[model samples]
Target: MVASTHRDRPIGVFDSGVGGLTVLHELLVQLPQEDFVYLADTARFPYGERSQAELQEFSLQIAEELIRRQVKLLVVACNSATAAALPLLQERMMRTTLGVDVIGVVRPGAVHAVAATRTGRVGLLATTATVESGAYAEAIAAADPHVDLVQVPCPDLTEIIEGGFPFDQRVVDTVRRYCAPLREARVDTVVLGCTHYPLVRPMLQRMLGPGVTIISSGAPLARQVEHVLGSRSLQAGRTEGEGTYSFLCTGDPEPFRTMGTRFLQMPLGEVAQVDVAGGALAGGGPALA
Candidate 1:
């Protein structure tokens, strides 16, 4: 693990692919003065299809790389990874010199969806692995026992969004296909359980109608991040000046840089390519090799 914390160190965020940029978008807006380091594990993209053990290994490798960069905090922006690896990741971080805090998306989005529903019916759209993991269902039940959940397993939604042409008719049809059950279930509030879904939120809203409240991990998670920083005194405290951010990915950086701007809605200054050496990341993985 790296040395103890530095207040000026960037907050680290990671996902299986570009999906996590939705979370980064919110972080950039909510914590404008705080620097961030974002990692996209695109070499093994679409974590929905990966096994739980594999996801944990990939997460630990990514975390080790981020910790080497000396981030003050870590956010698991991928639902599939979060469902499988958050506990292990947190435990590993606790043994580190810095003991960085780890935040995942399921609980925050689930709680918000539960609160947003007026008809006691909520919908969830996530990757197959995330849906199968039952993380959102458990979180929603814990938050509000009275709420009913309708979950849809989107096996290919992430891949379609990752292709970079999201506003096309095919994308709309795919979203509509996933949203049909929510309409049938009469869910008044929906949890966009996968970070990539937010990019197609307008289409989702149109299909599900104006009344359905769409809850995603970004804004609510941003609030939680703010609270964590203030409580722990880890905030950058950079008043008046905006903080900078950069990108790291295990796959080719060219496509990452081109496609990332759409999801991030901000200039992706420079993207560096990294290779993750797997197996036991308790300081085993090298930094951005």
Candidate 2:
């Protein structure tokens, strides 16, 4: 861990691939005054399939790199990482890091889902590890045990989205197939457990129907950021200035740059690449850091 300046530095956000861009988009809308540094671990993406130990190691390495960059706060925008590494990262930070704060998406999303469900029936769609971890179920149960929760693991959804595949007929068909149980349960609200799922909201909406509310962690996660910043008096004071966003990736930047723009609905310039060697992040050739 590095010494933190605790200055008004940019907030750090990261994901397994480009999925976290959905969270970043909401953060931008909610806190436009704050700057952000986003890192996409594209090298070992589809974190859905990685082992718990591997995910934790990768997450800690990424967190160390972000801390080195002097980010004021860290957001684990990847749900799989959140499920596997959040507790360990939180403990490590408390003991060794400075004034920076770290938060994960599961609790925030779960909180929102519990509040939003009209019939107390919530459906969760996420990666296999996330479902197996039972993070959502625990969060919802802690908030409201009365809430009926259904967990559906959509194994390959992240890969499809990250690969820049359209949420066309095939994708919709896949989602419908995976969500059949949730639909059969007659749940009125569904939680998009994976960060990548937000990118295909339209398809989800169409399949689930207008009556069934679909929620993603992005908005609630952004609200959590705002609440934390306000509580700590770390809120950016500039209300009229344009916010800046910095992008970094662990793999080739070209594909990320191309897919990122469409997902984030913003033009992305060259992205900087970082290499993870021996479970540590090393700065590679700089395109844009």
Candidate 3:
């Protein structure tokens, strides 16, 4: 019999905004027995424009906060953060006794895109920061050097998905405009480099056409999370009840909760407003275990 460990601790997930909720959605589906704690740095939304040093600092602060909360795993669900700060975050975590695994969205998406592409022509739709970071390009090359990657950096896609209500024509037009280059490239596979892209996946799929396979981070990352937990014997053993989840945002909680439910497609319970350092929690009631 295995002694009880950190198995019951919630898995921590964070993004620049509600975009990482897309990753949480996959984790909830793939590992429903485990609970989750999600943090959104909405006050600093659109982290795509932030500098590498800032991203590293922000990622470290968030990681320390999650570690304080006793999270068993940390998932960097933001592409910009993953591209810029994953190494620093992981290195910092290595100093801790728990040393939680840090998984990012870039390599998994790249590997999936590479495996999915048949024609050797792949397209990437991402924020300007992610494209500029060149992380995906390197990952795709490491996975398969022969595959050609056409990357398009969209300026307004994340903001549109975050703020645009009712999914208006502007959102469609923006998505269409981004997909135009991918369409012109006639790519066999497209990678949604940003976590927020999943929310508009249907629209992206339609824009990219039915034949082109689209890959996102959530599903692939979810599988990796599961594997990490299982290999380390950190998986929750509960078999009778559904795992609970809650929200912590650096900005207003109401908007985070409201906008987040749409992204996660699940009920978002209590949301507390938190500071960048992760202390000074305000508002929201306790989440059920």
Candidate 4:
């Protein structure tokens, strides 16, 4: 069994922005007894356009900051970052004093989609960087080589959702445009490859129709988290009381609090600001302390 003190440490989750709140929501629901510290790199939001090297650097920086908080595990909730940096992050985490496990948003969803598909055809909707990275395709192919994978790279969908929720016609049009190819492919399963896409899931469902199974990273990733924690004997011992959750953001905390509440569909308690200097957290936030 892992040390009791290590098991008592919070699970750290990070994303480029509020999008990762969707993933955190599942963690909150499924692992209510475990504390969570979520960090949003809002100062560098919209990770969809960054280069692979930039993403790796950003992810490593975030991992180090989360490690500083004594997190028992690290979750890279952004698909773009996961695609670009999962291996490197995992390697770094293994070298930590705690040997924290690093989980990301791609493989679990891919496995889930492969299981959900009836026609051996799967579709993926993701940001440009994630799609271009070919992460989902690799994951799906690894899970089931026979499964045909169709990918749609939405260059602007993340921005559209982030710009405003309760989307308008433009959002509808963008979703439709993205789903058209998937619809044409007649895929019975679709993987939502971006963490932010869940915010527009209803619109995506309508666009893709009821016959398709939509797999997002949240639910499956939550299960993986449970398994990992349990296997390592790191599950929280609390049997009744709910766990506490806190927030940290590299940008202004107010916007993160406001936007995150909407995304998580839960009251986001205090949000603390993270001072990022040279891409590393400089530790100004009370949450970071």
Candidate 5:
């Protein structure tokens, strides 16, 4: 069993890659006093195509690493990872770790989507794995079965956003194509099913038109994190100083660092590189302090 005594430590957030930065951005805005550590499993690149077992194993490995770092809370910032591993992670953590909490994006986003839709028609734009897992569909259905859901599996949107081409015409065109069916179905609200999707919110808004509302998982997820931390009394005390941000990547650090700066709208000092060897975190490189 892992023991945790830290109560004022930073929150840990992880994704298959830089997509989770969308959640991280919101967290920073909502909880400026809290520090954050973000892990991007860039070596895996996209968890969207992986098997359930594979994704769960990877999520467990990263969660263990974050636990080792003494985070007071854990946020499965990626929709695919959340859908694949949240239950197992929560169970394991509750059985072993103490004074820490784990939260995921799907349920919070689903609740918000259900609340925001006026026509009871909702659209979900997410990775192929999330759509296949039926995570959002089930969550929203549970919240309100009357909601008519249109799930669109956006294949390469994460890659495009992580590639720093989120605003390019090609990206907009792809978003337009993906959203066409939802528009035809007259969905009044669209859920940004993947964390990375928020990086292209402008494009999504344009494609969705003014009448349609686009909701990302960020704000809701951040609110959940805040609630958990507050309930546990793990919320940080107010500090005038700028909170620190730490980043880790399982692939080449340079590209992730560059793209993170672009997507987060802030300069990421340095990104450390780590490797998963034999399904465990092994090598560790330097990270910005």
Candidate 6:
């Protein structure tokens, strides 16, 4: 075993549930030498329907949990959480002694969509909270002021995908319904604004047709992670073999392990349980119910 250093500390990532694993899959492939610690706040899963206040509280709780584990950087892989809490999370991290860098999914996906679109018309399919947050709109506008973004709030899509994805008729119907407006808009690029959406990428592509480019946060977010690690000189030093990863969840570890292995599409070796009950997180601000 090599001696541990500040650079060897694992990157921290959190999501409401297993959806974030899609982002993790990209990171594992892009930065094979870096270790990661991913936390699933399954106790507060399906952030899509939650209010901004609730999502922010949940995000802060999860951030404190990951920080306790000595993470060198932080990644918020859930769109709803990012929409509600990215700025707050970044501020909290900045106050930490380590000042861990924080990155989120929405902006990266928006930037990629702007770059990929030929018609300057981008489509977004995400949860209700994410759509309402206006994060994607701001990000796309910042990337290119001339770009037009068509947003569809898929209130039930995240839950459908999170339920697991052999993708039944209901899932197909839901996806088709969501894709209709984008197809009508004739967007040249469609952004999978929610991490869970990537798992059903094939269906999305089939529905959107071959002429449209599909963008997901995984690839672009992975690139951003690489850039952050390089700029901070925090890249892991393990050169000969791939690095290790571990899991934490506020809900049952068994289900997270089972669904996570499928979502992650990789060996989910072990999953530990974490409790962020009110009394446990003083720094997270009076705990959330």
**Poorest 10 consecutive residues of model 4 by lDDT?**
280-289
Candidate 3 residues 127-186, lDDT tens each? 888999999999999999999999999978999899946899899899999999989999
Query: Candidate 2, residues 97-165: lDDT per residue as tens digits?
Result: 354678999999999988999999999999999999888999999999999999999998888777666
| Global lDDT of model 1 | 0.89
- The lDDT per prediction is 0.89, 0.84, 0.87, 0.89, 0.83, 0.89
Tell me the tens digit of each residue's lDDT in model 5 across 112-221: 98999999999999999999999999999999999999999998887777766627778878888898998899999999988888777877888888999888888999
lDDT for residue 239 in candidate 4, whole number 0-100: 80
Backbone clash pairs for candidate 2 read none
Runs off by more than 4 Å, candidate 2: 1-5, 237-239, 278-289
Q: Report the candidate with higher TM-score, 2 versus 5.
A: 2
120-225: candidate 6 lDDT, tens digit per residue: 9999999999999999999999999999999999999988888975779999999999999999999999999889998899999999999999999998999999
Separate clash counts for every candidate: 0, 0, 0, 0, 0, 0
Candidate 3: Cα lDDT at 90: 80
Per-prediction TM-score to the true structure, in the order listed: 0.94, 0.92, 0.93, 0.95, 0.91, 0.95
Candidate 3 displacement at residue 88 in angstroms? 1.0
Tell me which residue pairs clash in candidate 3: none
RMSD of 1: 2.9
Backbone clash pairs for candidate 6 read none
Question: Residue 148 CA error for candidate 6 (Å)?
Answer: 0.5
